[model samples]
Target: MPAVLVLLLLSGFLSRAEAATVVARVDLSSQRMTVSVNGVPRYSWLVSTARRGYVTPTGVYRPQRLYRMYYSRKYYNSPMPYSIFYSGGYAIHGSYAVSQLGGPASHGCIRLHPSNAATLYSLVQSYGRGNTAIVITR
Candidate 1:
């Protein structure tokens, strides 16, 4: 029985580890982002989501593209460094408005500290866009 239990536990671990290695979970209500690797929490940080009228779409997504340095043409040429574009125009990116994080301040984008965004970008790149999933929830 003890051997069987040990095998079961190992099975669970292997399943989780064999699954997607990188996942970025965003909680809109909490205004936070958590990244996990192989079922282990890797990084957690405050983030800024959409404001009043704007809405940040909540769904499961794989990164569509990555831009280390990008500017928003729709938003007065605003800077969006380390952008991980998940949805059409929405993305997880670094913002210059560090003071505005941890709240609803974005125009529908997920904003993070510049350094944190860079770290996340690197992780996505290393893990492969197809291997990383972004799960946004309210």
Candidate 2:
């Protein structure tokens, strides 16, 4: 009976976690990205943005397209799978390293941890493709 109760509880917790609606908000000054679900913060990660002169634009945008396998041979040697491009030449995509975050590191797109990016991608894909809006703030 105890084992059964524990299993039930665990299942419930997992389900809740999976059903979370993550909203990613980026702060350029602090180089931080806050992920909130239903108004509650689920996780926070350091992020990098465009250089001092080229800053990430602040506005409301939605995920207009999703690419599972993207390769930019001219710019990058690596392939960016599971990329969600929200703006022109800007996207939230998976990175090979978590260390590259938290500074002026990207051209103009928001870079995310591979796991976090994948999770966010799946969530957006599952919820509703055109409905998810990402609000990038200064």
C-alpha TM-scores of all predictions: 0.87, 0.73
Runs in model 2 deviating more than 4 A are 1-22
lDDT of 1 by residue, 4-107 (tens): 22332364522434355678889999999999876678899999999999999987777998999999999999999999999999999999999999999999
Per-residue alpha-carbon lDDT of candidate 2 for residues 1-138, written as tens digits (9 for 90 to 100): 223223323656324333334456678888887766555666787766786566688765667889876765546666666788878778788777578787778767777777777877887888655435465777
Top TM-score prediction, candidate number: 1
How accurate locally is residue 88 in candidate 2, as Cα lDDT from 0 to 100? Answer: 78
Worst 10 residues of 2 by lDDT: 1-10
Colliding pairs, model 1: none
lDDT comparing candidate 2 with the true structure: 0.67
Residue 108 in candidate 1, Cα distance off native in Å: 0.5
